[model samples]
Target: MEKQLSKKIKELVLGFQINELTEALVYERIATFVKDEKDKQTLLRIAADERCHAEVWKSYTKEAVKPKMGQVRKWTLLARIFGYTFALKKMENGEKGATKAYDEISKEIPEAKKISEDEDRHERELLQILDEERLKYVGSMVLGLSDALVEISGTLAGLTFALQNNKLIALSGLITGISATLSMGSSEYLSAKSDGEEKPFKSALYTGIAYVITVTLMILPYLLLPSSMFMVSLSIMLLTVVLIIAGFSYYVAVAKELSFKKRFIEMAGISLSVSAISFIIGILVKQFLGIDI
Candidate 1:
């Protein structure tokens, strides 16, 4: 017997069917490129489950719905660029909004509750098995990014107030940043080696790459702005520092299941504090030495 569902309920059920079908395709596509046999099998299983779910919803709708092919491409591309762990976890997080809909649908179709339970189970399994190799070096990345934000931002702030010349500040900053990048990379190498990390060279490389990228972003404002626009360049650089801190914190928070707010506040506070103190120090030093440039 076909049960009568309200128009709104039918629409919601169709939406769920579409989502399941899209995720099924996304997982299937992603599984093809996964190198690890275990991971690929896991993805295949999840994709099968999603397909089954879509079929369940389709039974209620009595009408076939097309999967969102655009979303399938977007997630697969994201997985390629950001790694499967980050992309899949991020996509799963977006599913939280569907919980209430699932609850609503469960009252009409009891099978919806089983699907919800399966989704919960899948999330738990993902958490346990999605540990990628790159995540192991997140500590090295944190070290590089945090140190660059604090040291380079402070250095740039001091130089901006003291030198008052954009080109000169950019040159000095590049020199300092390059030297610090090498030092940080070598230090990470030694530290990782001493700690018996499996791949110390890779750890150092991650650290160096993170540091150099941060340095480039921080220094680009001064290099691009006019020589007389020191204050504007300084403002833009500071904003970029805040953006970098927020972005990395959010990335780590999502990937590691950590607290985004706490991480962002801690890092931004430390970096900005150092910049402020250095800015004041620059004024003091310039005035005391009577240096005009």
Candidate 2:
């Protein structure tokens, strides 16, 4: 019984070490790929933090028990096979799985729960790091793209209602697309710079390019159709629906705690609110100013 308990403790220690190593590697990858110099520096800091965490776990394991050479080798092999991506994926699966295994052995063995808690702390720290830097940009880009698609698409639809000709509708859409792109891109750039964060020029440039691309693609269908009001309106609505779904899916994926119904309701509410305001503005312009295309 004592021997069995000892083996279990060794396994848990090895698992914690593997998790820390995987987190370190993730930080390395993020640092390599991130365009913003500040973001890259942040990732490097996170990687150093994770390395310290791994060292602590290793020290504890060394003090806890002496495992056979074969056993140590086997665990190392397992860690390498799982790789950083797979380990992070598992961690994101939830704290429950990691805790379950830790809980089963932590009480029976000394210092096991402490190690487990350390791993949990490391996971939370990694999450906070991601939230602070990468996730914010991801959320901004997604929301920005979604907003541009729905707003500009609705604008085109309303203009089609007034224009009643495909060529005229396409021309109006082109103008709206260009105007929205410039406006959104400028807004994003200035907002990033104003936040007191070091804004890399490349990050801002890429964001501008992406904003233009997403908006242009969203409105292009309306331009390609024949000079029919019905087809143009239909195309815009379809694109809006697709954008809403895409945005909802992204929100749900990132917001794992939220139920599907709740995420859908929240995202749908925001999309509808924006669309409604844009539509009202369009109607008022067409009626009051005689801005018919």
Writing each residue's lDDT as its tens digit, candidate 2 over 22-65 gives 65666666456556676467667767876776777676566333
Q: Using Cα atoms with residue i matched to residue i, what is each candidate's TM-score against the true structure?
A: 0.95, 0.54
Clashes of each: 0, 1
User: What lDDT is reached at residue 229 by model 1?
Assistant: 98
Off by over 4 Å in 1: none
* Model 1 RMSD vs true structure: 1.4
Cα RMSD to the true fold for all candidates? 1.4, 8.2
Find the candidate with the highest TM-score and give its number.
1
> Candidate 1: TM-score?
0.95
Mind giving the per-residue lDDT tens digits that candidate 1 earns over 1-293?
67888888899999989999998898899989988888788888888888888888888898899999999999999999877778888988898888899888888888887888877787558545865777888999999999999999999999998999999999999999999999999999999999998899999999999999999999999999999999999999999999999999998898888999999999999999999999999899899999999
